[model samples]
Structures are given as structure tokens and as C-alpha cells.
Target: MDADTPRRHDASPGQVPHDLLATAELVAGGALRSRDRMWRAGVALGRPLAYALPTTGAGSPPMAGAATLLLCFPFDLEEMPAGCGYRKIELAVTFDDESLRALDLQPGAGWAGPDGARVTAFGLGRNRLRWTFEAPRTGGTLSPDGRWAQAVLASPAPLTDVSGRVQVRGVIEHPLLSGTRAEGEVRTRDEVPFSLTRADVWAAAPLAGRTPRPGAWALTGHESIGPPGERLPPGRQHLCLAVDIEKYSTRGNADMIRLQRSLLRVMRAACARAAVDWDACGRQAQGDGYLLVLPPETDDTRAVPHLLDGLAGALAAVNREPHGGTRSPLRTRMRAAFHHGIVHEGDSGYAGSAVVELFRMLDADPLRALLADDQSTDLVVAFSDRTYQDLVPQGYEGLSPVGFKRTDIRVKQFAGVAWIRSHGHAGPPPPDLTAPV
Candidate 1:
């Protein structure tokens, strides 16, 4: 055959060359058509039924044949129950004919009948050809249920140049496939307990469609309910107040520090007006008494503008130092689950109290009056770069009395938060003041 032209299978008599007989033998032996026939012929030719000839010689020399025969197989077979008739036979071949020496071979086996009852062979190479056969399906019926057949092919050397065609010519005898569906639902309930003073009943409702806000701080106060000399149920009412400080971190900025102090002063003034004892309000000089719930550390760098603005207004009222412009606007984003609640005992007598009870009260009612003023708010605060440092008092001033005295306080700087502890006593005095100054 010419190097640039394809060899016709039905060439005129006397046109087929003697050397082409080997190629003809490959075709006639089913190497280019049926897999079963090819296996039978290979067995007859001393080649194992499972042995496939390498397209290239042992030393990697290319095969001298016009085309490397890769695969051959009959198309359709009986379908198992619950199985669809999907047949695919692929062959990787290479063409060495004069007209298509560089062409790659790809032949496939497929079925065409509506029920996959008809089989055909097709391939793409120097050109495309389709071969059809009218043979009845002879394989035993596939189980009514679907079954799986898997085969793996491997070669020592990469089968790069081997190319051939697969001709599937048979009828399918099984039915189409089907699948099963599962049916079912689930339900649950969360019961959170809560208690509130008569005045805070309205504030107990959800804010912005969220759960009711928990109290910011809890105060355990003993009030004499009966005669002064009478021992009426211990003559003291233990009041546990919960306070929730929203945007605590945002308010930790320098500006907000001043504002917070001013707010504290205002709260004190309010307590004075209400004839409430500010000392008994559970005020700790060192750290914020309530635990602060913080989000997992994040990479967000946007400072909360509203928090900064609020701090600015608060500082102006306190007449304290204004936050320098060193504040970076980047604020860490906090998820709802990031939370920490702390309890401070102004009297030092409540340190050994149940922490769970305190936390539960806080979780149930996070907005309660800690100061005599009944100024309820969230306990947790978000901090900004410049303000975070200013609000978080450091050293002895930031350490709780119990923490400073017992040396139980721990301080570390990570992701910008300065942490301190109060071993269990009220926090230390403010930095700007001395014992007798």
C-alpha cells in the first residue's frame, strides 16, 4: 500500500501484496474484530489466550506491521437484573501505512438497537469505518439484579505505539437497569432556662431576631428581708446579675477607654441617684468582671467603625485622654460561638461560689444590673488596635487583687490582646492613682 493512502479491505484480486499476508492473518484471526475469536486464534497460534503481543519489539523497536492491533471484542451481551446494557471496547493502535504512518488508532465497540440488541464496530484512524454483524446473543442471561465485571490491563513498557480496532457484533438479551430510593426526617428541641427581674422583662426579648440577651454581670447580694434581729432565711438576698457588653473589643480602643471610664462614672452617678451601693455592685478594679467571648482568631483587619465612634463619644464625656490616631481599622471578625464569661467578686467572699451557676445566670440573662445604677449591658467587648491596648490595663493595675497577691495571673500578648488574671481577688487599683496620692 502507498504510504499516504489507506489500504482497502476489499482491494481487487491480485492487488494484495505477499508481505501484507501477516496483516491479513491478524485481521482474519480476529485481532481487528472479535475479542473471543482473537483469543481463540491466539491460542491456536501458540499465543496464550490472555497474552497480548507488544506493539513494539523487546528493544523498543517499532512494529513493522501496517497497524498495531490493540483490542478486539464482541459488542453486546445479556444484561443482569437491575443492570443497563452499556458496552465499551477500546483499542489503542498506531498506523504505519504509507498514507498514515503517523496516525493514532482508536476503535470502539457499541450497540445501536433501542434495546441494545444490535452490535457494531467503529474506529478513527487514517479514516473511519463501521462494521456490522447479525449474530444472536449466546451468553447466559445476566442475573435479574445487576452485576459488575472489572478488568485491568497493564504492560511493562508504555503501550504508546500499539493501535488496533475493536469490532462488537452481537445482540443484547437482558432488560434495562433500575435504582432504589430511601425515605425518612428528624426533629429536636433546645430548652434554655432564664430568670429576670420585673423591670427587665421587656428587655428579655430577642434582639434583631436572636435569642434573648444574657445578663452582663451578676451580683450576689444579701438583703435583710425580715426584722434586723430576725434570722429570716439568712436575712440576705443573694442577687446574681448578668451583664452583656456588646462590642467590647471595639470599645477597648483608646477613645473607647475614656468613654468606658466616663460611662462607668455615669453609671456610678446613676447608682448614686438610685440610692444603690456602688461598692456592692461587684466592681473589680482590675479586669472587666464578666468573661469576654471572642471569636476564633481571624485574619480580618477591618476595624468596627461604630465601636470606635461610640468610644469617641464616651471619651469626650469622661474628659479623659482621647485615643491617638494610631488605631488600625482592622477588627477581627467574631463568630457567634466565640464567647467567654468571667465573674468578679467585689467582696471576695463569692470566689468559691459555683462557677457554673454564675455562668448559667449569665447565659440565661446576660443583661443585668451589676452597678447600683441598674445599667445593664453586655459583658464581652471587642478591641481595636490602638484602643485594645489602652483599655486592657497591664501589670498590677490590670491584675485582680487575688491574682496579684497569689501570683495566679497570666499575661501573654497574642493577636494583640493583653491578658491578665486576678487569682480570685478584686482587680488592682487604677494605674494613675496611688494608695495615698
Candidate 2:
């Protein structure tokens, strides 16, 4: 009845045609457009919080829905083994109770996008799911430009939440590339450039109160996300570990790619032997390193030391095997640092001061100097004073206080007392290796 609003026509009593009402009902029931429905659903879910889409071209922004929620998960294909046919990614989505219940979730089959990606695995949580995607066959290529590709959740459900805000979180495996190139390898021989802005991201709303049974979500509670009741991911204490390859940049692209892939396989095996549950732990694959987070409630205090011992053992085994290459047999050396403190899961991934401290520990000058001087050491692991004091004194399996020496270290904003432990090199540092530490 507003002056400008259009009103449906009303004819005098019987003036309307016989099938008009039925036709109107059918249209109302089935005519909802996908985009329109998504917009309406998004509005119903809550107020717009924040969202992002991958940029295909410049000047013009990427496509966005009315209440459109866009997400992306980027992979560094250049760091991948050439012709690697299968690739997997774990996705996490978070949303509130009202919005969650309104959803018509078809977990394994819900995703839509590029031709190569498929949801090969998935796990549900009260507010999140561990969604795994296996990219297209050998023809699929992950880009090095950081802004490689993206995925879209085709169906948007009407959401009902009081906060009027939404959130998304994701991680791009192998976000960077190392320098090692294999013989006959066609990859870049120099270090691949990196920048944070080009990173791809994806996010899912929290599953508020839906308790997905064990099989419903793989590796139940490998790492803790948080108890739901959110404005954001609640801050909690976590065991943080940062692992980096020593002199990784010195190898050619082929060698770098192979080294990282082989090292990851070994690392996973080590975690398994130590009962570390690498998959369950919040893990992110850096080009030449990894950032792992273990929630306090799920990871035992002995987890760190046991894993260190396992890593040392695993590295030795890899060295003992016949490496196909002629120029110095490929050997992997690593630097690992451990710390425990408050960390919060955020829109991007895990964040907090503790996480930053762990990275700082890895970059500390003393740790680097120790590795350089001890050419015979294959692995050098450092523990934050708190973590060292709490776990080192308690002898747990292969972990003993004998090899650990205390050291004072500083890097940028962090200055601290830590304990350094060395694992004797399996073989001489790949001869004359001048790679950056």
C-alpha cells in the first residue's frame, strides 16, 4: 500500500482464472533462485561479519553474494613433487547454533568449484569439520603466485544467530618453496618469492551445539579448537612447535621439492611412532617447515620430547636409505623449537603471542650458530624455558637430560632462556652446503 510499492492485482471475486492460485503456490515453493536464496539465507543467518574471495583479474573485485560468503584455500604447487597426482587439504567451518541447525548439510558432497578438487575426507565437530579435498588428477596444477585458486560453497542456508556476524578459517599447505632442484628438474632454480597478501583462504561457521559422533568427524579431538560460545575462538593454552629445514635454500628446485615431501613423510612416521597424531594436531605445512599446535587438553606433556626423539630416529633412517641422486646424497637437517602458552583460533588460522614466540625461537641467532658450528648434528631442537623446565627433567623414553644443554637466546622482540638438544648428523652435512640457516 506504500505509494511506490507494487501490489498484486486483485480482480473482482471470480474474475481470477481457475489455475492462478495453484500456479502462484508452485512458484512460491520452487522458484527460489540459488543466488537469491543464498543472499536471503545469509541475511537470516546473521549480520555480515567479514568475507573474502580470490581475485582473478585486477581493478575489479571478485564476485560477492548479497549476504555472500566466499572462501579460498591456496596451495603452492611449485613446491610439490612434479606430477604429484593426488593432493589433500583440511577445511574448517564455524557457525552459531541457530544458523547451524538451519543448515541442510550434505558434508562430503557439499563443496563445489574447480574440476580437479573433491572432498575425499571429512570430520564434524560441535562447531567445525575437518574437510579434506583431493585435487584433480595429474593435470591439476597448484600455483606459486599464492593466489593460485579458490572454492565456493554452492549452497547457502538461511542462518539464525543473534550476533549478526560470521567467521571463516583455513590453511594453504606448502605456502612457500625452497631452492633445491633435482637433476633434469624443470622448476625454478632460485628461491621462490613469497608475500602474505597473495595467500588464499576459506572459512566455515562453527557447529555450535551439534555433537558429531566419532566417525562423523575423523580423528576426533586430535587437537582442540575450543568450547563454543563465541564472539571469536576463545583463548586457550596450547603446545606450539615450529620446525624448519636447515640450509634448505641451497638445493635446486627439484631437490627442494623432493626433500620437503620426503621429510614430511618421515615426520608423519615419527609422529606416529611417538603417538603424536600429526593429523589431529593443528598442522600447517610451510614450504620448508611446519607449524603445529597441540591443545593442552588433548596433548600429553611428554608429547614434545617423544616427538623430538622420533624425529631424530626418522631422519637417521632416511639418511641410511639409498638416495637416487649422484651429487651428494640428499640429507635433511632440521631446527625445531617448542613452547606452550595461550593461543586463539582466528579467522585466518591459529594466532596469539605464544605462536609468535615459537617462530622467534626458531630464528634465534644462537640456535642457528649452534647448528652451523656442529656440522655433525642433523637435528637441533630448542625448548622454551617453561616447556624445558616442565618436561625435560622428567625422563620419558628416549628423551633424557644428558644431551640437552641450556642456552640464552634472543631474536627480535623475544629474549629468553631455553634448552638446546642436538641429534648427531646421520651423514656429513651435504658437502660444502652453504644454504641459509
Best by TM-score: 2
For residues 254-298, write the lDDT of model 2, one tens digit per residue.
Answer: 456446655665566456545665435676667788878875665
lDDT accuracy of residue 147 in candidate 2: 16
Model 1 Cα shift for residue 304 (angstroms): 32
Q: Supply the global lDDT for candidate 1.
A: 0.24
- Candidate 1: C-alpha RMSD to true structure equals 34.3
Error of 2 at 157 (Å): 22
lDDT of each: 0.24, 0.46
Error of 1 at 250 (Å): 4.0
- The per-residue C-alpha lDDT of model 2 at residue 97 equals 32
Backbone clashes, each candidate? 71, 30
Error of 2 at 6 (Å): 71
Q: Per-residue CA lDDT of candidate 1, range 1-437, in tens?
A: 43212122211221111111011111221222232221111000000011122343332222222122222211112222242222222112222222332121112135333223334434343323344432324442222111111111233333333223322222222221223221111000111111112211110111233211112112222211244565323122222222233344554333233233334433333233223443334332212233221122311122122222222222222232111212324221111111122333322333323233333333321112121122221122222222223333332233122311111112232122222121111122122111000
